[model samples]
Target: MGRIEGKVAIVTGAASGIGAGVASRFLAEGASVLAVDRAPAPAPGTDGARFDSLQVDLAQPDAAARIANRCIERFGAIDILANNAGICDYRLLEDTDDATWDRAIAINLTAMFKLCRATAAVMKARGWGRIINTASIMAERPYPSLTAYTASKHAVAGLTKSVAIELGAHGITANYILPGAVLTGITAPLIAADPTLRETYDTMGVVNRMAMPEDIANAFLFLASDEASFITGHGLAVDGGALLKM
Candidate 1:
């Protein structure tokens, strides 16, 4: 049997990038997956035996509730919750406007808070759960021009830790994954616009190549499995040793 056979998972930002990758992996492992994203529909790697999709903006206050309800309604249970939706603003502090900052925090941090709250309730009642949030290598280190993005991701680490501490007694584990120089939907356009950036990322890590979404997805799969039951409130780095130089 698959590691998570007969289980159910809720994966946000599932239209593309790491979210889609995670959803696809979970489904392949025999889990019923609800792939959530702001896109009208998610069409990606999730061709596994059991999969579903939900379209909603994570920034919406009611979105968390809607996603939670819809997943339970369709899949019957919430075994894994992956809060992977995020937005990054490429601006220095001086160029960062209030709206840009607010949107960054709303999508990256606040929305995740609501999602954890909504999903953890059901997980608690079920007596077991795994909650994984996508943070960035920037959560601890930093780059030159992404103040808002860095701050929000930094907050993700702390928020996830707090959630883990509080939910551990209830058999729910909360952790965050820190990715570095990943080639995803968000970064693809940027790299295409500036091809030089691609080389920068490719060589940024000691492994000498930028990471693919699937590379990050594998980490989520490990954490979601029963093998990781005792692990919680930690930042799992899937960064290919990028932090070593940072």
Candidate 2:
């Protein structure tokens, strides 16, 4: 049997990138997934497994609850919740407008809060649950032109730890993953636009190469599995030591 056999998971930002990669992995491991994204339809992955998809903007107040409710309505229970939706803009701190900050925080942090809050209610009742939030190396470290992104991700890590502490008694564990540069469709254009970014990307992580989406997805799987039951309130970095660099 697969590690997640007979389980049900919710993957946000599933249309592509890490979200899609995780959803695909979950399906392969025999989990039923409700793939959520702002995209209008089910994303391409998993070799034709017919997982459900919900398109809702995570920045909206109601979107998180709605997605969680829908997952419950369809699957009757949620075993895993992966908060992976995020947006990054190329702008310095002074150049980042209020609207940008608001939008980034809303989607990257607030939405995850709402989903975790709602999902935890059910998980607590059942006495078992796994919550994984996607953070970044920037959460602890820094980089240019990612002020809003870094701040939002930093908040995600804090929220993950807080949730873990509060929900541990109820068997709901919350954690965050810090991924380095991962090769995804989104990054393709950026690299294409400036080939030099590739060199920078290689140095950003300890592995000295851009990571594949599957690399991070596998880490998510490990954290969500029973093997990690004792782990909580931690920011697990999958960044190949990128955050450790001075």
Candidate 3:
């Protein structure tokens, strides 16, 4: 049997990239998924199993509640939540503006907070849940021009730990994953512009190659599984020892 068999998971920003990868992985592990994203759903010819798709921009004030409701409607209970929706831009602290900073907070951190608040109530009532937030290695060892992303991800780590402590008594687990230099379509264009740039970025992590989406997804699968019942209030690094390079 698959590790997460019969579970129901909610994955945010799941139309593409890491979020999509995690959703696909969850399904392969025999979990039903409620996929939330602002992007359009995959088309009819898409080559994988389907999920119940909810289109909502997470930056919107009520998006979290809407997703929580959709999850309940589709699957009766939310066994896991993968808070994987986020965005980043390369701008130095001096170059970043208030609007950009606010946008980053709203999307990367606040929305996840809201989701946890909304979903936790349900999970608490049910007495079981897994919450996995997507943090970044840059949250601790930051780079130039990444102030907003770094700060938001730092908040994510704190939030994960805090929630884990608060919800543990209810049989809810909250954990964060720190991923370094994952290669996605978002970075594909940059690599196309200059292939060696990918290699340069790869070397920033202890591992010499960029992490694939499946690599991160595999970790999510583990965190949501019964085997991880004892793991909570922790920030697990799936960064190929990127912290060591720092």
Cα-based TM-score, every candidate:
0.96, 0.95, 0.95
Tens-place lDDT digits, model 3, residues 16-85? 8789899888888888888888986443233234368889999998899899998898788888999999
Clashing pairs for model 2 are 206-240
Runs off by more than 4 Å, candidate 2: 41-50
| Most TM-score-accurate candidate | 1
| Cα shift from native, residue 12, model 2 (Å) | 0.4
Question: Lowest summed-lDDT stretch of 10 residues in model 2?
Answer: 41-50
Comparison by lDDT, 1 against 2, better one: 1
lDDT of 1 by residue, 146-220 (tens): 999999999999999999999999998999999998989888999999999999998888999999999999999
Write model 2 residue lDDT over 1-246, tens digit each, in one string.
889887889999888889988998888888889999888545545644437889899888789789888988888889899999988887988999999999998988899999998898889888999999999988988789998999999999999999999999998889999998988766888999999999998998677888898999999999889999999998898987787784
Give the winner by lDDT. 1
Better of 1 and 3 by TM-score: 1
